[model samples]
Target: MRDYPLENRGAFPPHVAAGAGASISLAPVKGGFVIHLLGDAKSDEAALKKALAKIAPELGADVRKSAPNQWFWVGDADVSSDRLTEIQAGLPSQFALADQTHGRVRMRLSGPSSRTVLAKGTMVDLSADLFAIGQSAMTQIGHIGAMITRIEDDSFELIVLRSFAGSLWDELNHMAAEFR
Candidate 1:
């Protein structure tokens, strides 16, 4: 398996990395950065709560459960400035990111056709009744490791592991192109 190093285009559009089995686009969203909290037995909820409280006043963020098991304390992009430091300081343990070697990939999919495109590969009923705006989930359509999140009424973002990014993108692009 060949490896393609990620492009370092700080604060711009994501760098696209493509290889034999997968493709990834790491887009940087302004003002917000994802802090990967531990998901294993070592996860400390008390410390995470404390950290969230400390940053709440500074960033005015709203804490929401990301998936069935994951919690995310998100604020606007401005939260990146001071709130991140506050969260780090408040937590009893340091935040660690996911290992890149595991093929975890993220992308920002938005615009008018985002939802329509994702529907091609996803079976999880992307309709408004099931997956409404601001909702996120972890699931799989076929062999794809899907992290589907709704950005708006017409836009959605899909994150998958590097091994499946190309397949996911191709499916989405094919569906989305029809809308253009």
Candidate 2:
């Protein structure tokens, strides 16, 4: 009998260097968790957020709005199954939780020219004033569906399906070539 062993790997390369002193850079944000939270029709963002804070005070996850009653809770630490179960059990009866850590991948596109590079693929206005820090938008980048979050004045995080990560990474790299 033949045995097959599978190794864990990231969706794309660890890091892509734009160039020397490049004005734009792209990198995969691995080893973290992505949890999808859905609130009942009666629950509002404020109520959900308040409830979430009580249930997972130490999780330190960034709650990014995906829709009116939906949000993606993301963090840079890996969560154990026991901990996940605890969170689920603590949730209010009006909310549902689904772990999407493996199904979704995150990418960080940063630097002075990051917005300019992203503009080539997305229609969302990347202007600082319009898309201020901490704001998130679920939009299309080229043909891939992604959630773009402004994490800083010159940095953005893009969350995409694991399968589409490579294509999106390539497209972003191409768009940033001029600045490299």
Candidate 3:
């Protein structure tokens, strides 16, 4: 993997994933962190709620549903790093941690053109009112695990696994090329 430091002054690396599909790298958002977790029918929602409620005051946790069985808790500026131990302590054993280093891929797309290109294949209504800033949802773009978020008025970010990264990138690039 090519290293692009946060301080680097250039466009992000074109293809960020090592596996088969197209991928782009999204710069880490300034203060927040994305913690991926998995829960089953047997999983404890009460514990999950208790954990989040405990940390909410400090981190400002917001739960965003990505898929039927997956979810992400976004912690705010003061809340993320400060309470890692407490957060982990609160989580059940089944929850898997997916942050930058361990995840298959992390890519961000934000621009006026983001939505236009995305609309070509995505069925989800990405209108501003429905998917406001910081709101995240997990749905399929074709067959991939497309976790899309409206980062700004015109920009959106999609995160998929490394194996499918290339295909996703190619799909978006092909769709966006016409716009250019």
Best by TM-score: 2
Looking at model 3, residue 10 earns an lDDT score of: 24
- Candidate 2 lDDT over 117-178, as tens digits, reads 88988999989889999899999999999999999999999999999999998889889889
lDDT of 1 by residue, 55-85 (tens): 5665533333444335544444433324345
User: Once superposed on the true structure, which residue ranges of model 3 sit more than 4 Å away at CA?
Assistant: 1-34, 39-62, 74-86, 91-101
Per-model TM values vs. the true structure:
0.55, 0.92, 0.60
Q: How many clashes in each structure? A: 1, 0, 7
Q: All candidates: CA RMSD in angstroms?
A: 8.5, 4.0, 8.0
**Which parts of model 1 have CA positions greater than 4 angstroms off?**
1-32, 39-53, 56-68, 72-86, 92-105, 111-113, 162-167
User: What CA RMSD would candidate 1 show?
Assistant: 8.5
**Clashing pairs in model 3, backbone N/Cα/C closer than 3 A:** 21-165, 21-166, 21-167, 22-165, 22-166, 22-167, 59-79
Candidate 2 lDDT (Cα, whole model)? 0.86
Cα-based lDDT for every prediction: 0.52, 0.86, 0.59
